[model samples]
Target: MNALAAQALISARRALHQRGELAVRVAFYAIILVIFSALWSAAAGANGGSISGYDAHSLLWYVAAAEGSVIATKPRMIESIGWDISSGAIVTEMLRPASVVGLRLAAELGEALVRLVCSLAVGGVIVWLYVGQPPSAAGIALFVPASFLAVGCNLAAQHAFAGAAFWLRDARSTWFLYQKLVFLLGGMLLPLEFLPTALADVARALPFASMAYVPARLASGHVEPWLLLVQAAWLAGLLACAGGVFWAGERRLEVVGG
Candidate 1:
């Protein structure tokens, strides 16, 4: 690899590992899992021990899988992109021989990998203890590729959203709306299975499902091998689309004020 790529990788790794962020992030995931488990337990007791084919244990496990998958990835690439723009660092970035987009992409991937390792190590143990046995060996094996696809799709989506910063200058509203949609459509709060048929159909067709739902479903043994292939295809397609958007945004770039 070239020096710029190497430097970007190093920077990404440093950013992820700095100030014990990995530990803090893992703790956050664990705390969320605890809260989710308690809520599920309370709901199960009130509802006579089942809600939508999942008891407290299964629900907790599902939440754990979802949380782990989410915490494992870097979802704040847009915010970073925005900060880079606002700070005028982007001007210097654009002057580099390397592709700014490519550098950011590599950095984000490195950061995501670091986060994924920390989450799986800490969060996996918590899930096993409270939720149940960890996903089976086969399920764990499947999660490797499933997670790669999921994170790729998620980063692509996030970068595409961040690219809007180039045009909007202040994209807080857009980012908030996009995040809320992800929470709902990505099945982070509830599995798509529980949604109305029409909504669930839409969710499945969108890229959001590949982020949390597909991997979580695979972790829970709810998906078929064929479905895994479909998720991979979605990841590829989303990445391509994100790349196109980033390129177009770069071409249209106008740096305001310094």
Candidate 2:
């Protein structure tokens, strides 16, 4: 555990050294939020300034929070792990003291957490300009844990998907499919409440909601603490699944001489 934490910190520090890259990423994140916020405002104005209980102001805040919590703007874990496995790099990582997947996850989380904070800071200011206020203090405070849970669930899912590389030699296609799921089912663009009732119910029952919607809702001032419980449940299950898949992949690689 200490080793994993140390690796995470090291990776985060390394990521910070890429200042120019980080600047571009943060700028792009801001641009996306601004554009989407404007579109939402226009749509809301055309529809009496509120849709599904979200006014233009509220929608902008929601978009800000949601996009901030996401927008990593780095290599997705699926591609990274896929590359490692395909290039025979996993062989060296397998010899490390920590579990391969755990180590990779820690490093990814470290960098992602740093990026998330930076993106959210910029995004928060943009939304504040739009709405004339920041998210509620309670909302901002609870968003911390909610965002962590969201990242946990997301990374676990990606790890599980990457395990397919043990056989397919590339998981990038899976990553693409997962991105769409996050954009829609994960509620990156809008709240799941806007979806049809039956579809919303199904989406909630799935693991995607725990990835983005749960944190975004919390950040947008929906202080339902129980939402974190659901996120936690999904995180636990996804983590287990990721572990199982990666372990199986490791076995396959070992037997097949990757």
By lDDT, the best candidate is 2
Q: How many backbone clashes does candidate 2 have?
A: 0
Model 2 scores a TM of 0.95
lDDT of 2 by residue, 1-258 (tens): 498899899988988998898899899999998899889989999999988877777677778777766676343768888888888889998888779888888888888888888888888888887776745678767778988788778888888878888888977667788788888988988799999999889888989888778888877777788988999999899889988988998898899888
Task: List the pairs of residues colliding in candidate 1.
Answer: none
Worst 10 residues of 1 by lDDT: 249-258
Report the lDDT of model 1 for residue 207: 83
> In model 1, how large is the Cα lDDT of residue 38?
87
lDDT of 1 by residue, 1-258 (tens): 885468657866786658477777888888897888788789877999987776776676667766777766655557777767655577787778887777776677777767776777776687778756744556656766777777777777787777767666665545566666667798877878789989999998888888887777667655455657877888778777767876766666653343
TM values, all candidates? 0.87, 0.95
Candidate 1, which segments miss by more than 4 Å at Cα? 2-8, 86-88, 254-258
Clashes of 1: 0
